[model samples]
Target chain A: MSDNAAPIQLFAKKARVYPKRVWGTFRKLKWASMVVLLGIYYLAPFLRWDRGPHAPDQAILIDMPARRAYFFFIEIWPQEVYYLTGILILAAVALFFVTSLFGRVWCGYACPQTVWTDLFVWVERIVQGDRVKRMRLAEARWGFEKIWKMALTHSLWLVIGLLTGGAWVFYFNDAPTLLEQIIHFDVPWGVMSWVLALTFSTYLMAGFAREQVCMYMCPYSRFQSAMFDKDTLIIGYDEKRGEPRGKYKKGDSWDDRGHCIDCTACVQVCPTGIDIREGLQMECIACGLCVDACDGIMDKLGLPRGLIRYDTTHNQEAREAGLKERSHLMRPRTVYYTAIITLVGAVMLFGLMNRAPVELHVLYDRNPLFVKLSDGRIRNGYDVKILNKAHEDKVYSLSVKGLENVEIRVQGAGEIKADQLHVYADSVGHFRVFVVADKPADARENVDFRLEEVGGANAADYDGVFMSGKP
Target chain B: MSKNNEIDKVSGVETTGHTWDGIKELNNPAPRWWLIVFYITVIWSIGYWVVYPAWPTLSGDGERGGTQGTMGWTQYDQLKEQQAEIRARKSAYLERFENASFAEIRSDEELYAFAVAGGAAAFKDNCATCHGTGGAGSAGYPNLNDDDWLWGGDVESIHETIRVGIRSPHEETRLSEMPPFGDMLSGEEIADVADHVLALSGRAEDSEAGAQVFADNCASCHGDNGLGDSALGAPNLADAIWFYGSEKGDIMSQVRKPKHGVMPTWEARLDANTIRQLAIYVHSLGGGEE
Candidate 1:
């Protein structure tokens, strides 16, 4: 260690960012993204899908009590949780593909944190005035105007947070019913706790945490650079043209000077408060707001636009070298990601299309595996569970194979015939089945219990073993 | 450490007393919001300690032997509350079970399902020791799943037998006994009767002498065909399901000195609804008579 080495201070006070309001193409684009994303998030639960009378009518619902997940036309059983894995994989690869091409568009436009923070900032701006006024108010002494303005801003932020948390819970329950419960203040503790937790987190994260969440808390920002290539699009400064910059007068020299007028419009409008003219840093979200701000500045100064712009490193280098820039969209990374996305999507589609309406599970009795009857026959007991996934009651005829002279008898079925088992709609029917068979040559014999839906085409088979005393 | 107290010129913030090469560490404090949240958590922890049992008492003479917070919450109390909730949920079904007869219970699908589940749980706790967990009995005990039963197999008969057990201490118990004929009948006669009993099940050759001995000694309780009557709690000798071993020696020993098995009366132990549930569960095991 160096003798003059200083002991490091681990903590640093956060520098508050007050992004000034700007009217440009990217700003409009960001507003549109926020409106559309928040609209879908807040309104998605109210969208109704008819699942007949047996299932919930919510278009997208996670019925925790029923252990079922319904997505439009598809219903997911607890046993079929692989579909969730498939959906997650698809989402991940799609994000990778988009990141490799456009660079952090998700972070800029589509992320919940960004949208909510933008909304909160918009509210703050509307209540307390824009950047300079907000800074002045923060530095000003305590007063009624400051107190009222700050209170109004926080109240609006809290209301938005409450709505956001409230909308999130509607996805897990029936929307209209839960809305009624919430109106009446009759929400269960389990649901109320989740609502409060999400409310507090949303309020804190969007209102105060803001860009600090992106800079330190978000894992995506830390690792997203791994997906970048030279051709990956990013927000950067054209240092080749912007350097040797000085303030422009009404009439300035056109020789040996850059077009940049040293106006800090880009930095003033940046949400993360990092100067884009310093070149691309990890804090840059690639939102292109800096480009919009610089373009406005260039138009005012009667100079060419794009001192800061969205460009690939390769293109920037090519432009510096006086060569034509080209884009490579078919790189191996993108190709692999696309292939995986397509394969997983196809597999999930096939599985959903061919999902069976009936499933059988058989558990052989362990204690006293085989009982000897008075007729000198051996019987094996099984607990058979039939999951009827359809919307109507179904009677399934059960039979056993791989054992000679096997007779199936169901307990508690009364006069409904020994082989016919009745299963209710969209529920599991548990039956204690006794399979009587002649003594097998081996101590344990493999048997298959075949269940065929009466008057229907669906069938399921469960493999089980029949135990007997050694002859 | 040295005390240079150098100032960083770029951001106009004071640096730490020490410097490395040309770079100095700035002494920037944490954000005010972070400090506020830290203080809030500290206050919350104090409140939590005041409301919950957070500390252990050194003295063993305390009521709880530890710090009992104002809330006075205990894991046992939580368990009891959870159990009470479950019992309240099942109270409706239990009321229906108490009011309904065996036939009515079997007819109603929900009531039948509840009975079976409750009965299976109770059976595992009480009856699974002597009878196997699945009711496949040992050599002395009878297999509940088999067609042959010493008493009766119907649900009502099973209920009555469970209430006042076979040869139990209860006054109304189903009592039957096979007398030990070792002194009355000679050794040769006992062997002959044992052979006749085995022959009734086709396990041995039928002999005239064995038939006479069986009619004289066992025919009073065991019927003429050797199919013992359920009314008398006499086991059927004609079936392959035997309470004791079916070997020639075992039959001869039983004829000489019969072993009687007693089942405890459940009326004194279980509630009426539980006894009925057990009866239904036993009857549903596949061999209950119509």
Candidate 2:
């Protein structure tokens, strides 16, 4: 350590970014994506599907109290949580496939953070004017116009955040009922806490954090380059054509000069405030807004478009060499990701289609595993749980096989039939069943409890063990 | 420590003035927002210490309990509050359970389910020591799940038996005593009677000499056909189930000197509602009669 050296500062203040409003093809594409994504998120909970009389009609709901997840006609029980794993795998592989072809497409278009921040910036622009006016107001004194405009912008951002948070909670409950509760200011504490938490996070992340979230916080931005190869499409600058730049008048000659005029249009319109002329960087979201800005400038100057554009490293090299440019969409990474997505999607679809309506679980008694009745028969007590997922009450006849002279007795079933057990719709029937069998040759015997729906095709079987005293 | 004050020539960045071997660290600062978050967490920890019990304290009079924070919260108090909430939820079912008769409780499905759940919990805590976890009793303790019962298997009878207990210290206990016949009968006579008792259950051939002794000694309480009377707490002899044992030696020993089992009355030990739940639970263990 040096004694007379200048003191080292450990923290650097953030440089605020003010992205000027730009209009082009990619800007219009971003707008369309934001509208569609937000529309689906806010309106899907209100959609309804008729699940007959016994089940809830909400189209997409996660009923925590009931331990059921209903997505349109498909209902998932807690035991079938592997479906969620399959969905996650499918989503991950699909993202990989898209990223291998078009770099950071998910980050630029579909990500909630980018979409909400763009919406927030638009609200700011509407209230405080565009980039120059906003910077002027920030530097100006706190006058009545500045205060009211800033307050209005923040108030609008908060309202948007509240709506976003309120929409999120609707997925876990009946939307109409929760909306009514919210209208009356009678929301439950659990739902109210979640709504408030989400509201605060959305406001902070969208209104204040902005591009810093993608730069310093998001893991996707840090690791997404791993999916990129030389063939992957990325936003870049053509340094071979745009270097040795200088300002030009209307009548300037085109000899001994590059096409770039050093206008800084790409940098001014960048959401993250990074220059594409600096070459490929991690901060670039591949949003193509720079391409739009450059194309508009080229139209004005009678020069060709794509001084800064979406291009692969290989294509750029080929163009510089005066060769043809080609896209490789069927690379090894893309093929592997596609195969995984297909395999997981197929397995999930097959499981959903073949889901059984009945499930049987048999728990053998732990203490005194077998009781010797006075009649020389060994009786084993079992707690049998029958999950009847049908919409109507079902009667199931239970029988035990692989044991000699097995007699079944169900407690509290009231003699409708010896083997018939009535289970209510969409609920578990818990029965204390005692299976009495004649003394077997061995001390223990493997048995199967077969439960078949009465006059129906649905059936379930559970493998169990019958214990007797050692011979 | 020495002042280098030199910039690295290759990267054109200043050094942090510390060198390890040939390496000099760059003078790149972290983002200000990260430092601001660290400061916020530090302040939050200070606020947490004020709001929660964090430091130990000693009183002027030498008491050593820790300082009670502004919230005045403790884990024991939280546990007590949670337990109170559970009791409040169960009071609705417990009130009905206490008032309803055994038949009324049995007929109502919801009330029966509640009673059974309560009974199962209470059984594990209080009764599992003697009667097994599944109510399969050992040599002396009666298995509540079996059809053969000494003091009736109906819900009401089970309730009464649990309340008073057999041969217990309670004044109204179901009292029964089999007089020891070691001096009254010869050893040969006791053996013959044991054979006749086993014969009744088809365990032995009909013993002509033992029949007269069993008729004179056991017929009054065990019945002539050996179907036991529930009121007298006498076990049935004709059934294959045996309290002591079914062997000839066991029967002879029992006849010579009978061993009486004592069940403690639960009325004083547990509340009335818990006793009723226990009775319902024991009766529902696959064995209660109409």
- Please give, for residues A215-239, the per-residue lDDT of candidate 2 as tens digits: 9999989999899999998998998
Predicted complexes: DockQ each: 0.32, 0.24
Q: Which stretches of candidate 1 lie over 4 Å from their true place?
A: A1-7, A184-186, B1-91, B185-196, B204-209
Candidate 1 local lDDT, B1-290, one digit each (tens): 33656656555566776568866788888999999999999999999888888788889775667777799997878999999999999997999889988888887888999998899998998898888788988889888988888888999999999999878999999998888899789999888888888899899998889899888778888999999999998888998888889899988888888899889999999998889999999998878887
What digit string (tens of lDDT, one per residue) describes model 2 on residues B158-268?
989989988999999999888898878999899888888888878888787789888888889888988889989888898878898879999999889999998989899
Top candidate, metric DockQ: 1
**Local lDDT at B123 for model 2:** 94
Candidate 1, pairs of clashing residues: none
Q: In the order shown, what is each candidate's alpha-carbon RMSD?
A: 5.2, 4.9
TM-score of the B chain in model 2? 0.85
lDDT of 1: 0.88
Residue B78's lDDT in candidate 1: 93
